[model samples]
Target: MSYTKTQTNPTPFPLVKVGMGHLKIATAGSVDDGKSTLIGRLLYDTKSLTTDKLKAIEEKSKQRGFDYLDFSLATDGLIAEREQGITIDVAHIYFSTPAKSFIIADSPGHVEYTRNMVTGASNAQASIILVDARNGVIEQTYRHFFINNLLRIKEVIVAVNKMDLVNFSEEKFQTIKNEINYLATKSDFEAQKITFIPISALNGDNVVEKSTKMSWYQGETLLDYLENIDTTLTNDSANARFPIQTVIRPKTAEYHDFRAYAGKIYGGDFSVGDPVLVLPSLTKSTIKNIYFFDQEFDTALSGSSVSITLTNDVNVSRGDMIVKIDEIPTIAKELEATICWMDKEPLQNAQKYYLKHGVNDVQAKITHLSTILKTDFSGVEENTTALTLNQIGDIQIKVSKPLFFDTYKKHKYNGAFILINPKTNNTVGVGFIKSPL
Candidate 1:
């Protein structure tokens, strides 16, 4: 078999835009299941890697006494990861095609690195869960899938890798696909779109190019699917939410009265003449002007970081949320959230921590541990006592101040928070707001 290097240009496909800026993907699988190799294969096949990178892979593969190029080297950048042949941290990779730009978060698959996986998948719009054909679906596979479901990732690609080891057996691929399909029926995210493909990351079959060995398979390659997948967020449909990051004031002789609230739009768009409400203070104001740097825009869409001058100065400051007057979020001192515990210390009731919701921070305490969720998507263990490291559970929390937020399902950016250990100043947990409690 000959390994021919291809140029880094994507083949033309039907142009499709989902109104999203860039696509973010998280990859997960069991150890030695070729998760890193699959990513490496994608980069290699896409011609995203530089000449030095290809040379490095060739030298490393020869040094390791491997006949084929070790594509895993392309993503496993850490010295410990390269030495141990296991990914320990999340490695972010950026590459673009003619159709779209992509950011892949290569997450660790070890059982202990479940926290790491959550960190990667939290911001991802899609997920790629790899399953070794020889091993089929295992415990780790269930955990990864559960995380994707919990995050509400709408799209998933289940790549049954190492087809070469299975002699390109169609039966083996079908069995694995059937297993995942059955698992999906039990998942909370029943509407998730899952695509299964047989691939050999080592030999680059069905990753970027069609696999001649599996002639019965008539689906697009993994690259084809990702390039055309719709990754648009639902922010367009949600209410406008802009958490004030800072107050922009130019104390100059010429523009001494310029005071504007600066932040990124987290939800729907905002227009110049829109009626806005300042949260907590409940101050009413009208947008006088929207400025993106020196240029002014009539309207600002979600995710755009800009400054807005209000018609009246109602004492707005940092941590204040400016939202549409008609579509106000729940403002409450107590909240119910699904939290993924990340610290080594178990999450106990009455434990105080600093909760950061967007740019706002407030003192919070866990009031109740409702239930400990099982990661296998089987069922929930109700009335759980505590959540240990890497365990996810539902809890009620009391905050020092009222928080203006939406449900995570409704608005992702406005619904997420991080619990900081006040004493140690470390981030201990991540929470997704369910509703005001």
Candidate 2:
């Protein structure tokens, strides 16, 4: 089964930038899909690895009696991972090219570690899903793509790896590409952009340099694409949302009257004189000032950790949210959400848990068990009674206090929450708010 070259769009070589900004990337694929090797290749070919690291890899590779360097050793950091030759936890690798700095999260591929993959990919602006050229599209590939779509990661690169093992065949790459494209049509996120690239990570083909073996392929190397892709687009462009983490008060003589709310801006920007409303209390006030450390600023953008003072001294404390007057989020006690169960214990109806949404922690209980969703793009199972580990499902939850939140699609930071088991204090599930119920 093969697809024609015209079936996939040809990627034009991107012009390299001198100094691009930072990018966070998460990798996903089944076990032995060469994910770690691809990352190691990126570091080695880009001259990002230090001398000591290279020497250690060479020594280890030789001791193992391998002809080529065991590039997977660069990212398989844990002893368990190295011994088993599989990633158990998310391994973060930081490297820089002349054009950009990258933080790659090497997520585990085993079925039991699906929660780890979700955590690794939650903050990524882009993702790279590796598919073994010899093994086409598999079940794990579907789960990876689904999670990326669920997280609203706009950019995805499907790197068909291990071309060397398959004799650098273009047909193999096309088959996998077609399978993934078909799956994309079933995805809820229609705007997700996917690019297909054929590469052999072990042999350094099409990773950092153009591959002569597959001359029929026409696309920028993996590094070239990473260097040129934009990382500025984020959910921060949505309505302004600031969740107060702490109330700062300097009772000292010089700044006796200063009462500022401190937290990182999650979405949109805030400026002096902007009308804002404090949540739960519903008190209104205008922004009096913004401060980052000891410095003062007229405006603070999203992701900025700054202290803000309101024109009126409305009583505010930790876990309180502030939002723009015009773009207020939903304030409700009951809501419906999609959740990924992460704990060993199954999720049951009317189960009590501590729901931590951003900086706010509230007592919450699952009131109703909805449908359990299939991760392979298959339709949902209706009337699901319970949710087990690695299972995703929809459910109705009632919180002790009103929550200020938006749908996950509308605002990433403000729309997510974690369910902590009251008795064990362990994160049992992660949820994305769907709507007020």
Scanning candidate 2 in windows of ten residues, the lowest lDDT window is 1-10
Candidate 1 Cα misplacement greater than 4 A, ranges: 1-21, 233-236
Candidate 2 lDDT tens digits, 197-223: 899999888888888899989988787
Question: How many steric overlaps are in each model, in order?
Answer: 0, 0
For each candidate in turn, the TM-score is 0.94, 0.94
Error of 1 at 174 (Å): 1.8
lDDT of 1 by residue, 241-313 (tens): 9999999888999789989999999778999989989998999999989999889999998878999999997
Q: List the residue pairs that clash in candidate 1.
A: none
Q: Give the TM-score of candidate 1.
A: 0.94
Looking at model 2, residue 383 earns an lDDT score of: 82
Between which residue pairs do clashes occur in model 2? none
Q: How close is candidate 2 to the true structure, as a TM-score?
A: 0.94
